[model samples]
Target: MADEVVSRSYCCFVCRNYVAEHDDIVSKSFQAHTGRAYLFSHAVNIVTGPKEDRHLLTGLHTVADVSCSDCGETLGWKYLKAYEPSQKYKEGKVVLEKYKIVKDFC
Candidate 1:
């Protein structure tokens, strides 16, 4: 089971406490509608922000507006989109993957 985990979740480039395990990631290293890279997480520690139609692929998705649960630093965003029969898997998912995150330590 340990080999299946490709990464570990942490605070936004500050705190080292574990937030979410990589095992729950729906999509890893995936490209977003903004032409940027992101990881679709099943779990995260973030507060909801204003919903907007920023990206075309995600529709009018709300931002998670997440900061570090331990420290106040911009962590990531959870895309809250309207549920669809074909896209039900991405309804309550998060996007927080940049150099600022902890991917692997060993």
Candidate 2:
């Protein structure tokens, strides 16, 4: 029999709603307001709040709070605009706190 490849993903810790695929992870060394976070190229099953400019560890960035659509739990933020040129790559990406999500296999 051909072996099947199991896909790994990250789910909302509060409701187990799949938010991001493991393959979409950009960085696992990001820092959030609470603790460590992961930068993802894309996120699903989430809703973005109002955009605001916040001075983060990196610099000033326009971000929007991201929450799980299922349970309305604040998961993290999505980078809308990065003021610093070096951080521009983060624009349009989502960062989900490590503690706010759980891993799942399928």
Candidate 3:
């Protein structure tokens, strides 16, 4: 027999805030709800502070609050660092193409 495995799509916990994922959270408040994990379409290093400059491209392992642009779905998170040299920091949103999903995440 051939090897068989199934990997489902997952969204960021932040983006999924106001969508169907939100309802899942509400329903399974106490229990671990792993039903609606979304497949992120992009990968942005989750950095804080300014939106410019070149820093270490260290990605986050956990989904630390990422909200989707469309329908407000929480996609996967990118581990990012704060844009130092300034406190008024802007968050980084990882951009991913539709096809890149397989190459990047998968």
Candidate 4:
């Protein structure tokens, strides 16, 4: 018999739609309008809203709201563009509020 590995991921709190993989998390120290959030390198099953410039804690960034494709719940936002040179790494990344998702194992 061989040992099987379990994969961990995050799902939408409202509908349990798989949103992000555990391995894709880039930072856990992020803050959102509600509270703590996480930065992810990749996200799935989400719909991105319009892009608008917002002054974040780091700097001004062009961001779009991300919602669950299944339930249309506002999950978080996607970084479309970061104005600060040092914040450029965040562009194309996604931030999901800690309270908006639940841990899922498969």
In candidate 2, how many Å is residue 30 off? 0.4
What are the lDDT scores of the predictions, listed in order? 0.57, 0.97, 0.30, 0.97
Candidate 4 lDDT for residue 50: 96
Q: Model 4, 1-106: lDDT tens per residue?
A: 9999999999999999999999999999999999999999989999999999999999899999999999999999999999999999999999999999999999
Q: Write the per-residue lDDT of candidate 2 for residues 1-106, one digit (tens) a residue.
A: 9999999999999999999999999999999989899999989999999999999999999999999999999999999999999999999999999999999997
Question: Which of 1 and 2 is ahead in TM-score?
Answer: 2
Give the Cα error of residue 78 in candidate 1, in Å: 0.9
Residue pairs with clashing backbones, model 2 = none
Candidate 3 vs. true structure, TM-score: 0.23
Against the true structure, candidate 1 reaches a TM-score of 0.61
- Which window of 10 residues has the lowest lDDT sum in candidate 3? 23-32
TM-score of each: 0.61, 0.97, 0.23, 0.97
Can you rank all candidates by TM-score, best first?
2, 4, 1, 3
Position 17, candidate 2: lDDT: 98
Which pairs clash in the backbone of model 4?
Answer: none
What is the C-alpha RMSD, rounded to one decimal, of candidate 4?
Answer: 0.7
